[model samples]
Target: MGRIKPQTLLLQSKKKKGPTRISGTTILTCNLVVGLIVLSLVATYRQWSNRSRSQAEDGLQNLEDTDAVKDLKKFDLPSYAILNTSKGFVFVELHKEASPEIVDKFLDLCQKGYFKGMSFHRVIKNYVIQGGDDIQGLGAAEDWIMKGKPHSELAVSPKHEAFMLGTSKAKGGSKEFDLFITTAPILDLSDKLIVFGRVIKGQDVVQEIEEVDTDEHYRPKSTIGIINITLKQEI
Candidate 1:
């Protein structure tokens, strides 16, 4: 081949160098774009993680503020009332959490011997055994309403099961001192009665009281008096 010209060789060298410079510049630009994309994705993930963590913490705090949690904390200790009846003694578990005002009034009456010698005048077979009237009469009503302004709203709605103790409202809109223990489940009366306690022991005594002979007005033929009432607390 003929000897190449210096000018031609120089032109060819310049063409190769131009392409190399362009390739290097393109590679650097691509690397910068990829780096920026990776940085943006990492920042977005971190923000989402932080937000999720904050929401979870707020949800936990809200759960702690619920009424159920407060009730659980308040009723850590158990409270009860012991009814010494002429037939036998019956143990009652007070539902202070469900009806605080009613329970307090019942406990106060018990401490003051208000229930002593009060006979179980009304006895309905398979229904209820009611007492708490100072007089041995059946229809005579006593003031069961808390004396001053009520400490809380009237808990006329019951939330108790069988063998629960409750009071009735008199015709004059005031609660009566007459109290009753259910011999069976009574859901219909829940809206009208105020439940304060439930029988935890000596249910047989209640059964015996229920089996007593009754007169035309469902009054017990023989006296079944409340000898005394006492309170207890368990930690």
Candidate 2:
């Protein structure tokens, strides 16, 4: 047997397998990176899912609103609106037969509680008391201008008389949202306005509203809000 040199034995003993040994810290760091990537993917998926669900809900709401408007337009039964104002309650008898579209618009607004907390923006002594200005942070966003809106432009209709509830007489012609109660007969309006209801009760309340202090622009100085408007179907 040949005897090996000490140096040769030492070199053979020092030779490694040529593979890098993994430390616990390195393994833990790799695992944490993989876990972070997984968590990020999960979070993104959930966010996208939530956004899709919200979009679907909004689309459904729009479709239902369209159906509701259709139902309101075809309404024929006599209805009444009891407007609970800041000062007092005012009763109005809706003339559905005379102005079906206009009356239905009013009814739709009432049903949606759109008039709650609305202020009387315009007040004219012995002229009219107006409310439903989009000023209460309510307006165009309400889908007010639908695809098939009839009589979008302002034009006059018959039956403008005292105590009548109808559209505004000026610019932004009410769009079925802005409304006024006539204190006296106003026939000088060349622009078309609607008269959908007649004041059946609370004439004094109407008078008080009309007589309230107003700025030069006819806007009420103090808040005269419509607490709420309730509608009832007449048999």
Candidate 3:
């Protein structure tokens, strides 16, 4: 054996060669770190997106609840009644200012489900279609009307016109409710009944209702009724 020189040792080390051996543990740890970083980024982005969408939906719901209060006040718009009937939907603009008592009463009744299944027992063609308290649950006619609180008590009368809603005392003195929609301009009933509102839209529905055949007492041969009445007003 001969002693190797320092220069020989240096040259041999330089020739020694290939890449450093990276262990399996090191490679796996590095890949796991990168995967965790990507997963964190994705979670953060999803949370942010969900929060933004929830905020947008809440904003829209609040807007609907208040319904542009500033605009309603500025325009002095009255509340509306959306009357849903078998024929179709009829929109009535309530005369809240003109007759607050009756208008409120009608709205109260609607809220109470008092007219839920009430029918237009009296459907006189070319004149009017009456409802409010007659005819039971869309299934059969009651042959009797549920009159307004007291037929004996009288209220101030309003002008009569086409599509106007009014109520009259029954011949038995216990009949009539909101009394219902008019299909034509009736001048005679001005003093006889109290008018609270008028149909603003769906006059065609009212016409169709007016044309429904009725029996001798003007009771509709087929039941025609209010499925529901919804009031739209400020929150």
| TM-score of candidate 2 to 2 decimals | 0.54
Tell me the whole-model lDDT of each prediction, alpha carbons only. Answer: 0.73, 0.72, 0.69
Which residue runs of candidate 1 sit more than 4 Å off their true CA positions? Answer: 1-78, 134-160, 171-176
Ranking by lDDT: 1, 2, 3
Give the per-residue lDDT digits (tens) of candidate 1, residues 47-104.
9999999999999888789998777755753488888998899999898877877776
Candidate 3 — what's its lDDT? Answer: 0.69
lDDT of 3 at 173: 33
lDDT of 1 at 47: 100
Q: TM-score for model 1? A: 0.55
Error of 2 at 119 (Å): 0.5
Candidate 3 — which residues are off by over 4 angstroms?
1-78, 134-158, 169-176
Estimate, for each residue in 1-235, the C-alpha lDDT of model 3 and write its tens digit: 9999999999999999979999999999999999999999999999999999999999877876684764554236438888889999988877776776666667767788777777887776555677866523222222222221232343433464678876653422342354667665555456555677778889998998888888777888888888988877631
**In model 1, which range of ten residues has the least summed lDDT?**
140-149
Could you give candidate 2's per-residue lDDT for residues 113-224 as a string of tens digits? Answer: 8888989887767666767753332222222213212333323444546788886434343554787787766564313456788899999999988888877667788998
Top candidate (lDDT): 1
Q: Which candidate, 1 or 3, has the higher TM-score?
A: 1
Clashes of each: 0, 2, 1
